[model samples]
Target: MHYRLEHADLSLILALVRGRSLARAAGLLKVDVSTVFRSVRRLEAALGRQLFEKSRAGYLPTSLAQSLAEQAERAEQALEAACVSLEQGGEVISGTVRLTCTASVLHVLLLPALARFMPAYPALTLELSTSNDFANLNRRDADIALRLTDSPPEHLVGRCLGTVSYRVCASPAYLSTAALGDLERLAWIAPDDFLPDHPSVSWRRQRFPGVVPNYRCNSMLSVAELARAGLGIAVLPDFMSGEQQGLQSLADVPPSYDTALWLLTRPDCRALRSVVTLFDELARAIRLGHAGGIPA
Candidate 1:
């Protein structure tokens, strides 16, 4: 007996192959663990072949299953290409473009560009996922990812928009009453313990080991808000230090992280008009706004 595989089956196989565990597969497919377990059992019964073997490590795919997954990946790529071709002929672009970026980037950079882009392309729907963690594009987690990094992943295609500069900033109110002589004496708002590995946080710890934070936050935007409220001084991206925010830079302690602003997306996703439009618009707006974006 012969069995035909549907798109869902193909996706399931690919996710399983990549994820190597039921939970991870479910996460990649955006489904529950039971769903993945049921699908695997169903596929095995329908095809009359074992796809994966349960091991102490995880779900290990058989050689036959690996081959099927490879074919499925190719099919998915072809489908994406076909969709892109069909979309290109149409004058109006309509589809959801998932963008993953840090909240700081959204607040300082993306919002202005999105405000204008949304009006121009009324048919397009934009979904923004704000997180410091990089979204996995290979599993279709997000169509586009905006990041600040020294090196971008080789798998994705994107443009390095420019350097994102960092600076120590505080409200004028906080600075006025504060002692100017000793930097360690000032109240500092630091990145949370969870983000100890964050470049800014690491930099602060190294530069001023004695400076204890009065407050801690994980989100860069929140840290900036605390600084703006005269709570404490914080290291913030240059874009956040806009004159309108009434925050002045502490020129005495200048620190820079050698990272570039990158707009990245999978090669297959780049062909879609929604992704292409937003990608170009962002690159243009960021470059224009920051004017070379202050070299890192």
Candidate 2:
């Protein structure tokens, strides 16, 4: 085995290992699926070892593949650290800050904060990536992230914004003819398996055992939209549902579910003035319930 792996090869392997699907890996790499497939095939041929096994469940990494992927992740982290080091040495406080969070959070929380912060620091540019998946702070996929978690990752440092609360909401049209006594009997729009561990899901399971939702969606925004359209009642964050038109919270379903909101940043990136300033502003906005531009 005289083969030497390149950074590109390692990156492909890492993407495949993490994404678990050719399409997903391609998306992450900003390439086509054919490109990913060809690259993986070439790497496997060069190493004379199978990296992944394909099945209906998607690509499963072999032991060697996992080891290589881990190395690639380490390399990524090191590169990010180096970048942060260089950023810290610079005196300029203006630059692009990449931020990531769930779509709901971006719209409900960060958007208002951003509206205020961006104008104040006109020289600062923001790149926002909204998704349900947690961005890899270690890889610098995002410079900052707003997350709702009970236990924040040890590797990251930031401030706890506040406690996020959820409530069951529905449109007035739907509630007019709806049965409010038995929650299990009401039409429900629930989060899909992607959010299986969400507080709302857990609350629903505990409150209405063995009950199935009438509709299910992966996006919290979609669930809220469907509820607002009179499709069904949805469990939504207070910030998301509070100011929506024609939507009313069910008094029967008390605000019993809550989670901690965190403004997280990589330790190395914390030294950057832009990151620190943004982090402080976001923390303040969230703590004061000012992020949504409405009273909490």
Candidate 3:
């Protein structure tokens, strides 16, 4: 009666049957250990049969699992063929992948990466939504996501893509009229999300060293705009100021402190070929794009 086979869930079952341990199965699947545990439970619930019996030592395959093992093998092959049909059309690979990310990444990093991806995979169409808000993975709102955090939510699985570091930056014209000593006299624009009232803003406040701004604004775009208009000095992620004309790094921020940029998926959703293929391609694009050099 287990006619329902979600590709990702089915793969987890196959991995468990082969490895006999959730931890080991997760490793082979390139996902965290917790993800393997949840998938196994979901599989049990859906099939109404216990596939594995866990002991202190390891998992023992149930008679039911033994009976279904061969069928699972067939299912795996079917999933593979389905992926080929969805992502590749002869020479071209195409699918619609939706992603949620921060404004900073949407503008600075992803734009260029996609330009590279499109030429490589012309069949692919990307739907990117950017905001400070985090999407609920349980709702299946986004097929993939990029976040500025290290660990993912309990039900999600992912890896840190890279680090985002900040530096003190100012315009060429403003730098001429001002000095670091003019700290007290300078105007500063700060994102409300990173303001003193917010808990996450603690690091930003510590980094400024008493330099308060003449003007205040919220969001990265506003900060970039104000800096472009010759408003005042502000601490910005290096990539933001790197490409803009008026902005220049006033001081090389030591890289010791950095925030992680992560790539993620709903743990259960990983089984979908559409999601898996896109996640892999995007991760590759981000990695290769970084090696080429961070976009200005």
Candidate 4:
């Protein structure tokens, strides 16, 4: 008996291996659970072998299936690389570059650079994903990422754009009679668990361990808005706070908190012309303080 495997079958196998469950694989494939089950059964019947075993934990791949999945992954990567090469070799650089970053970065840094980059490269299309969560570059979840970190992953290749400075700020109305020494006495807008290790949170904890925030939010933009409304003092990235009309940095509070901003990409993705162009533009913009006037 002769059996042939199709690209779709290989893709299904790869997705199932990665996802480890029919439901999850279906989600990845954007297909129904029943379809995934049917397809897997068909493949097994054709091959006269069970590729995966259903366990209490999830779908566990057999040794043979694992090998096949690895081959499928290699195929997928090679196909993607070919596509990227073709797009890069074209006269006009054109392709979707998926970029991920924290919401604050999107608002204060990437957006401004993107505004300039888009007009310059009209053929390039960008897909932006903003979240506080780190995007999985190894999994190709994002081709490029803007990150604020002291220790970047060694697996990725990128340039350190600049250092981001942080300061405590409040609306002029809220700070009218407030003294810098009495920061603990005033209400505070604090980041939630989403940013547990954020410099602002650490600074607040170290300076006023006993004080509890009057307001808590996960988003940096929300904290800024709260401070702007004269709600409370908030520790904000200088890039976000500097240009706001009503916000005033506490005179006595120095910009004590800082972190490195990095524009990172996967080694393989960096070879694409579009990725390289965007990466360079971002590094240049950040270094020049042109993106949201981010301080060098």
Per-model root-mean-square deviation over C-alphas: 9.0, 9.5, 15.6, 7.7
- Candidates 2 and 3: which is better by TM-score? 2
Candidate 2 local lDDT, 17-135, one digit each (tens): 99999999999999999999999998899999999999999999999999999899868865665565576664334666889898888877788777876665545667888765555
How do all models score by TM-score?
Answer: 0.65, 0.64, 0.59, 0.64
| Model 4: residues with Cα > 4 Å off, grouped in runs | 1-90, 177-181, 243-245, 251-256, 288-296
Model 4, residue 279: distance off in Å is: 1.0
Sort the candidates on TM-score, descending order.
1, 4, 2, 3
Q: Give the clashing pairs for model 3.
A: 8-271, 94-123, 187-213, 187-214, 188-213, 188-214
Candidate 1 ranges beyond 4 A from true positions: 1-90, 252-256, 288-296
lDDT of the candidates, in the order given: 0.80, 0.80, 0.68, 0.80
lDDT of 1: 0.80
lDDT of 4 by residue, 199-228 (tens): 889888988899899999989988988988
Clashes of each: 0, 0, 6, 0
Error of 3 at 225 (Å): 2.5
Query: In model 2, what are the clashing residue pairs, if there are any?
Result: none
